[model samples]
Target chain A: MKLEKIRPSEITPEHVYLSRRRVLRIGALALGTAALSACGLPSPSPEPTQTNPRVPKDLPTDKRDEFGDPANRWEEITNYNNFYEFTMDKQEVARLAQNFKTSPWTVTVGGLVNRPRTYDLDDLRKFGEEERIYRLRCVEGWSMVIPWLGFPLHKLLREVEPLSKARYVRFESLFDPDQMPGQRLSFYPWPYAEGLRLDEAMHDLTLLVTGLYGHPLPPQNGAPVRLAVPWKYGFKSIKSIVRIDLVEEQPATLWNTVAPHEYGFYSNVNPNKPHPRWSQATERRIGEPGRRRTLMFNGYERQVAALYAGMDLMKNY
Target chain B: MRVWLRAHGLQALVHIGALIPLGVMIADYAQDRLTVNPIQELTLRTGKVALVLLVLSLACTPLNTLFGFRGALRVRRALGLYGFLYVVLHLLVFTVLDYVGDLALIVQTVLEKYYIVAGLAAFVLLVPLAVTSTRGWQRRLGQRWRALHRLVYLAVPLAVLHFALLVKSLVGRPEPLLWGALVLGLLALRIPAVRRAVARWRDRVRHTTSEWRVANRKWRMANSK
Candidate 1:
């Protein structure tokens, strides 16, 4: 079914729209009067300044995945998170992670690589950045459209130069219990880890995200650095990286290790493959009132489907 | 005031306590504090309250059976009905608010999701119990009324299982298991042997208490003389 293009005005709730419009009008009137008196010239258009100012206009962003759906508000994207390292409660993660320290963080890259090195946050940023508006579909049957700012994972892989035998890229999050209280839970295997096939890691759509909505990543949203694999379920995009390893065999992931049947190793978002406990056929879009049909490979089928050409996703899942 | 409290206070407390969660949910909705997914928040909150009330209702019989707390029987019906009310609300939110009353989708979910099926079965079983909870129906059904209400023993466990299966990480979370344990303990108290033993213990305790009371009264009368 086709979803009618939702205009920006329709996206904002009525009360929020009215309040923001009033504030904008008052600000414009003041600016207009000042500009007229100062130089007898008309005030510059307020359109650019009034809209989302966090995301710079010049940043290159792909709009293909949006399909006319507007990006979720910054608050919705940041506040509603599934970083289990912080907490299981999605809304409480933001508040609990308010004091989390992300500075002085280093990600160690090794295992089946020629130029093994540990890069700090600054060193990682030197590879360059671009903005991509991607749909993040969680296995919990919820989704969000986020404008993420980061370079492709291929760039980092090229710099590291993986060995010929390296078959998988394993990612690990920080294991500090003092900072991340959720890590103290003995039930969960701490130091959250995830893995992707070497070729999948080299895909251009796979991002090593550092920011979102044109702002640096918040603590709850995987500050310092995180991975964003648009096609896979959100949990596959491991957060708060502290280690990276290239292995010959598939590495064990936290979710897969905990519950292999429910969360498969290749957690590509396939609506046909329903979760053991729930359906993946539809997802509730964050900030929206109703559910929407989930797309195959989260609507990145064109870019990533070729990667899984011969293999059956159901078995892999 | 003390006499009036003894007569009516426990019932009043039960009524108020059962409705507090609903009040909190409404307050949260009005204040926009239901988090990002308000429908999900409503669904989880209502479901949780329903389960809690149902468990509390189940505990009432054991309370009366073991300790001879006759007051426990007075609020049992109210607790069960309140639980039924929340279950209705929970299903309403799931149907109207969450699914927009999409019959096909709701039916599909009910068939496909085991948790939904379990919850639906629990709700189905509670309907007859809630309907016949009145004294008039109790009189009409006679001995059959007792047998009908025993369906609660089955319904409570199904509800607990529904909760346990609904969570994404049931292995890591012990809440559903804890609730299961509580239900099992309450069920165990219903066994005839256990009930008889508890009754005998209660009788012995009552006999000793009355003896002590008479002796204390006699001592007080002597001191006054």
Candidate 2:
């Protein structure tokens, strides 16, 4: 044969393939679909994460806020991180956490639950999964939008079946002093711990994230698994979790224990409440010029505000 | 070479050395290598440089006081000016880049954050020192100038405290503590009692060495006779 004619469908359009805006629009549409269906409507199959030539688009494009504000550069997202378990230097975390072993990890769910069970990584992955794009705000006055792959926390909680005595859900990170260098030094009360109220843990927006950017969670970003409560400050979403205990009384968290005056138990993203060391009114969004006005509950007020209806946010914060 | 270096060349070297950090920052910015959190990187780097140079400037007094080095006294003004420059750059990064020209937010931040308050106080304390560093102003103020410059003693510890407070926590950080110790040690050396004690020790050592030389000479002479 002299020559073969190229088929039109074989070649993807350059604009559709290369434009991040289009991908973000698609992500927003996906999120919109999820939100709509969540109200007793039939859930639609989520769009498969788009593979960009440069950046991976694995997380849902949140339909709310400015969806197309250029998902922070992938390098910025991965390189500039804050995982204190490895080291305090933001640049050094990725390098230090790279060698951390996370396989064969098990998380024990105990305390005031009807079914107390220790789950392997595989067991956690078996729960229903989705791509959720949410904004993460740090108490340090910086923010980032992340695409996380995980399931609703409620799914796992349902399986465990919390008893009537379960008022708060406690999460603890791996505390091996030999492995986690930060644990060796008592800068913080060792064995980083955090908690959420029963309702907050069971909220639809709460996620038990397992992966990010279509890859297994980076060691620095929290290895085997972690929690992602987008409505609260980043630290509230504990990383490299090893235990989940439901308690009748509010649990003592690491930050609260270290500096109770600064970090409250709730630690909800409230722009009105200023951190003792810094202002929370505005936050620098990574890869974006200047600071943006931080939103209430980090812009998830519509979905989460009702949860804290009468509670004084300032006092809780 | 020593003589030439002691004259004006050493001060020139100090000037060149002091500017290198700023040059590196500019080059990093131009080359697009300021890292992911460039604003933060710049802020922290400049703040560190300012604190280091401030401590170094303070060190000049102790160097001169203990060693009687005239050159140390000469470079004191230059180090202080450079430290002030870096402090300005640090504040510029925080206000312009971090706060982004929001005057209301800036005031709110300064009011609410104690670290910001401490840093601002340190910078304000340095302003008069930098302005009066000129030879003309120094001559005009005369004895008052020395009194005014003593404010650096207060400024340095506050700056270190500001640095300590701004970090995640001070439990593990030894850098700020080391700076604080150096400042305190230098200040302690300024006391008249400590200075007199050091001088007495030096005179005793000198006297003992001369006496030993004389005794050895007498013993040799007696043996020759």
Candidate 3:
């Protein structure tokens, strides 16, 4: 089934379209206006506050407004996680992951890089922060809009300095069977792995997330650090990342290795593509009323489309 | 105590124990604590409970046959009814909560997913068994009741396979495989040849052990005297 291309205007408010630039601009204007008003003139203009600058934008899809609150609650976001390292049960994973220690963590960034270096959790925190609310669509046909706080992944990639030979970026999760009980079972060959093409990894939307909803990331939701590839399936955003390897070849990911027919290396969220076990035409947003038609690349097509331009999405998927 | 439980409280105990999971699920729904996808959660939990209870009910016949537990036979009907109740709830949750009464979507889903077909088959097979569970029907059907009730044996394996298929992979999950093994074991024990073989082995072990003990005691007494 063909899905009509979703216009940016349909999903985003006009002001929200340039929110990063406009909000900062408005903040500066508001500050300048406040300064002007303090100096005092008889005639005063209306404050920017009245313009509803801080009011949250309605989420993508017309249904979001109809449903009122589109974003999944913080509790639901934190608790309902699919960290198979802990357990498969959505509710049990949070409690199980809580037992694992995320502090004193270090990620080794090596392989085909010009300047291979290890970054501790504290080192990662020093790269600065940005709060981005992105829609996460799981291959299993459920989605959540999460406000994640992290810097762009390219910042770290630049610091590491990828060589010309490095064509793919492989991510590896923490592999401790004692802490991650699911590792005890040979589920996905322990230390869950995910990879992306160099261009895809360098996308601005790809984030090395540290927190969500203005709070530190919960253990179940990949605490301390994880990748957020908004344009792809949730599994593409590997959790509890411990290693980043810039490789010449596309690294074998856990899901792709487990089920090559169902999960692909590029598991981009494509509504046209149906998973072997289930349909991907629509997804039920957590804490929402009903399913919405899934958009190509999970509605990040405008930003990430050029990366996959001239490539066959169906075959790659 | 065994006789009292057999004649009186066994059915009550089974009924109460089986209802606890359903009560917990209902309480979770009422409290708005039924996970993120409550519909899916409710559907899965109800389906699992039904499968587990169906297996438990099937085990009752083997329990009576192999272990001579008359109490197990007494509560078998209640167990089967509870299983049927959960199956009905499972169907309701899938239709009303998950699909929102979209019969077309349900039909599409059934066609697309083999697990759904397996589950439906199990549910359909149980309907006849449940209808004939009454004492009046049992008498009316006479010997045919036993033949009809044998459908449950087929239904249970299909239910387990449905669960296995629903997960998409049984490699990581042991619950489905364990349930399948249990049903297979129970069914194997029902075969007259297997049952006689087990009984003969058990009898031989018991006789030899007692004989050995008697000889040893006599030898000890003679030596002491």
Report fnat in order of the candidates. 0.69, 0.91, 0.38
Off by over 4 Å in 1: A1-65, B1-3, B201-225
Per-residue lDDT over B1-225 for candidate 3, one digit per residue giving the tens place of the 0 to 100 score: 877765788787898999999999979989997888887788788988898788889889878877678889988999999999999999988777666777776787687778888989999999999999999999999999999999988898999988888675777767789988999998988899998887788789889999999999999999999
> DockQ order of candidates, best first?
2, 1, 3
Off by over 4 Å in 2: A1-67, B1-3, B201-225
Cα displacement (angstroms), candidate 2, residue A44, comes to: 28
Chain B TM-score by candidate, in order shown: 0.88, 0.88, 0.89
Report the C-alpha lDDT of model 2 over B26-128, residue by residue, as the tens digit: 9999998888778988998899899888888888877777767778888888988999999999999998988888999899889988988999999999999
Q: List the residue pairs that clash in candidate 2.
A: none
Candidate 2: tens digits of C-alpha lDDT, residues A10-50: 22222333233245436545566453222210111233242
RMSD of each: 8.7, 10.3, 11.6
Chain A TM-score relative to the true structure, per candidate: 0.80, 0.79, 0.78
Tens-place lDDT per residue, model 1, A100-194, is 77777899999999999999876887887677889999999999999887899989888999999999999999999998989988999888999
Best by the lDDT measure = 1
Name the top DockQ candidate.
2
TM-score of every model versus the real structure: 0.85, 0.84, 0.79
Relative to the unseen true structure, what is the C-alpha lDDT of residue A84 in candidate 3, on a scale of 0 to 100? 89
Give the lDDT of residue A136 in candidate 1.
95
For model 3, the superposed segments whose C-alpha errors exceed 4 Å read A1-69, A121-123, A276-279, B1-6, B202-225
Per-candidate DockQ values are 0.56, 0.59, 0.30
